[model samples]
Target: MGRSFEDARRWMQEGTKAFLDAIGLLHGDDWDAPSGLPSWTRRHLVAHIAANADAVGNLVHWAATGEETPMYSSPEARAEGIEKGTRMSGGELLAWVRDSAEKLEAGMAGLTVDQWQTTVVTAQGRTVPATETPWMRDREIWVHLVDLATSTAFADLPEDFLEALRADVADKRGEVPEVFGTLADVTAYLAGRPYDNVALANGEPAPDLGPWL
Candidate 1:
């Protein structure tokens, strides 16, 4: 089995390539098009993905240094950071995202394999091991890639990451209401849905997902 760090790096790189390819398909005229992420345009989704690469980088830094680091010290600052990054022109935005992802990959690669198992306290107060950070990175890239509104679909996500995600969601199955149906149903049901709306899927959405759709 591939280690979590290896899985995360591979998936993150795959996602970045997909994101870039999707962005390349967009012309300036298409910037106004709707992304699958409701209320945000394609530009907004791309910018958010780029910003999150850095955010994941922050988490990695915390784990590597065993120091307390805050990407945005306050909720207001966090909002401002996203708003500012999202407002950049398409070329600038994509460049920033691409560059940041490269930097992040390099940073992640520098960590000792043993560091992958070291536990750390996140800015949110939850304790997690370094190994799980790749899962976090994978989720960000894979979900936002869909939110970017590419035709890639959830089924296109790597099997390793999807299976890991299926397992992760299963682990939290209790926290998610039973209305979403079976674990696989919940997995498929939550596709393209935002995290904040996850609770809603537990009921009306009937979470239906498979390779076909």
Candidate 2:
């Protein structure tokens, strides 16, 4: 069975902590080092993670008030926020990350059982239950943790969490082709693996251009 909101909240908390642990691996010269992600340095990735947490927290604010609010005034403003956050010292970056994470944690903890099923529209314009927010939160941390290129890998992830991730990945079997050709082509597509011009094992060649992660 899929996880309940509490289950997902606990999972997200643990996952974010694990990600923070891995952040220590990037120090000094490593801050500007490239993670496997083509365009993002380690610092840039951390900034993005922090900004996303704040954005999600904004949604929590909206859910609390029953009023729809945009997390950022504009896409350009969001990009500017990320860029500004990226300029902070590593210590400062960690602090920013910790603060936003706490905001998210507190928000999730405040919800009652009934609130889990409450419907809400996402920043992406996707309509889903408020309970489902933790799943998305987990994805941001879990995927970016790997993007850091740490020795830790998803194999060490909780089996239940992996099962959750597997279902999520499977759900995106069709969308992966929006970038790559097909499911067979991008084994770890949803897991944030890049398509390298290889044939997929199950799906056929895609006709559309692959978008950036």
Candidate 3:
């Protein structure tokens, strides 16, 4: 059978739990440390995750109400939210994480099967079914968990997910080079993440990877 919203939602739930689990282990001072992403501290990564939940909730809202809602208020709103989040106290930041997730949960509260068929535009302008919402949030949660730099790596994610991610990145980044390794390693290289698990067949540094959304 084809995948349903419930299927995607399950992935979302699992990923969210994992994200929170990683954060639960953080030391009080770890928030100030640098993340896997360059120039972004753990504070920035956490804020971005929280802000992303809210943004995905906007898409859910659009689907449920059939209203024209874009993911962000404007192009700058995402950056603004992250910056604002970074400045928040630890407790406040955690609150936003919990509450913003509820925004998505509540928005998806009573979606009918038909509503799941509603068309929505992604932040990248791709028109997709409403069913894609949870998966969007799902991918963000899992991928950014690595950015937290708390011993979580792309190598730790599911093999199926890494393969799916490879296809996704390859589509966005035309003319991808072949890389061989565990699914996670190849996925990391394809997603433009820092990767050491892969190398050129001739032992040269591989070309830069495509920037994943």
Candidate 4:
């Protein structure tokens, strides 16, 4: 069954906490280290995650007010925000991330059922109901936690969440492999990440998947 907004909100909170805790383990210099994402450092990933919270919050505000507040003024502005955030000192960036996440959570908590059902635009340009916002935030923090490369892995995710992720990725990619090791491995593979630990059915290498939003 699909998760309710309350369930999704709980997951989002837990996932964001886990991601924040993982990031807390990193040393100052680790911010400059490369993340699992290509061409993005830990700093870049952190900055993006922080900015994403504020952007999503904009959508929440729109849903509540029936106004057309976009997640970003433009794609360039969004990119520029991340770039600017990446240059902040480690302390500043961490504070920004924590503050933004807290604000978003509080905003979500205040939403009425009618408000949650209101339509809003995603940063990717797709229009979805506000109830979808929690799941969107859930995906961001959970996936980016692994991308942080700070000791957390997909295997560390809750089993139920892993199952949901598997289904989500499968929906996007289609054609599940016959010999996947774990739900986490399947999700990682479907998300277009390296799945060195995933065992193929025919002893062949994992196939390259197209980008997944």
Question: Number of the top candidate by lDDT?
Answer: 4
In each prediction, how many residue pairs overlap at the backbone (N, C-alpha, C within less than 3 A)? 1, 6, 0, 0
The per-model lDDT (C-alpha) reads 0.67, 0.72, 0.82, 0.83
Ranked candidates, highest lDDT first:
4, 3, 2, 1
Model 4 quality (TM-score): 0.92
- Over the stretch 163-185, how does candidate 2's per-residue lDDT look in tens digits? 67756675765454443433323
Per-residue alpha-carbon lDDT of model 3 for 124-143, expressed as tens digits? 89999988898788778988
Q: Is candidate 3 or candidate 4 better by TM-score?
A: 4
Instruction: Give the TM-score (vs. native) of candidate 2.
Output: 0.80
* Residue range with the least summed lDDT across 10 consecutive positions in model 4: 172-181
Model 4, 1-213: lDDT tens per residue?
355667788889999899788777777799999999889899999999999999999998998888999999987977897898888988888888899999999998888888999999888778899998888888889988888887778888877777777777777566866556677787777877655566678777676676564
**CA displacement after TM-score superposition, residue 164 of candidate 1 (Å):** 1.6
Runs of candidate 3 with Cα error greater than 4 angstroms are 1-7, 201-203
- Candidate 3 Cα deviation (angstroms), residue 178: 1.2
Task: Give candidate 2's whole-model lDDT.
Answer: 0.72
The candidate scoring highest on TM-score is 4
Off by over 4 Å in 4: 174-179, 199-203, 210-213
Better of 2 and 3 by lDDT: 3
Candidate 3, residue 169: CA error in Å? Answer: 1.2
Per-candidate TM-scores read 0.78, 0.80, 0.91, 0.92
State which candidate, 3 or 4, has the greater lDDT: 4
